[model samples]
Target: MTVNTRELSTIESTILAYFQALNDADIESILDLYSEDPVMLPFLQPAVVGANAVRANYESTFQLIRFEVQTTIQELVEMSPEWAYVRTDTSGIFTPIRTGEGAPAAFHELFLLRKMGNEHWQIARYSFSPAGALPPI
Candidate 1:
């Protein structure tokens, strides 16, 4: 399949929008990036599937902490006519809402995006984990 430049640009914009929503604490905007039956695999957590489950996960997270994220797109590939894969390195700081504690955070994320119709892209699957090599004991 031919990869249109405009389509590729749209995908990159969508990825940035995801991080913007997270940093803004806009759960609704974040959820809008995902498909109806999207799946999210958070680090060391059970796989969260479907919209409601995904909503709950973000809700709990937003309640606990606020995030400021910076993302660098490492790779973007068109997997099929309707699917694209994106890998990104993200670094940020999160402040606990309750304890008023702040800490730096970093992660590598993989997102599988599905082109909904012609121009719109939504994340169908996502996974993320801490960014770094395992520490030696």
Candidate 2:
């Protein structure tokens, strides 16, 4: 099957916008990237479901810290005409507002993106986990 460059570009941009919003600490922009009923599975945290809950979760984090994320799209697969999945490697530095403590963080993320109609793609599901440590074999 032939790959549609325009569709692929749109999907990639949507993923980039998500990280950009986080780095900018723009909650509204972040929320805009997600669907009405989206799910986020963050590293070491319980699953956060729904747009409102996702908003709250980001709000709480943005309150204490701001992130600067650099993402590498490892893989992107078109599941259908309207659905796609992306795997990315993300690394960033987060700085705390109150104490000024800053630390580097890295994670591997899997995102499911769905095209709402014809013009836009939004995140349907997102999950990420720490990237460094390897599990025991």
TM-score of every candidate relative to the true structure: 0.91, 0.90
Off by over 4 Å in 2: 132-137
| Clash numbers, per candidate | 0, 0
Best by TM-score: 1
Report how far off residue 111 is in candidate 2 (Å): 0.7
RMSD of each: 3.5, 4.1
Give the worst 10-residue stretch by lDDT in candidate 2: 128-137
What local lDDT does model 2 show for residue 53? Answer: 94
Model 1: per-residue Cα lDDT over 1-137, one tens digit each: 77788778989999999999999999999999998889999988999999999999999988887888799999998877789999999987767787666677788999999987664889999999977532211
C-alpha root-mean-square deviation, candidate 2: 4.1
Local distance difference test, each candidate: 0.88, 0.87
Q: Which segments of candidate 1 are over 4 A away from where they belong?
A: 132-137
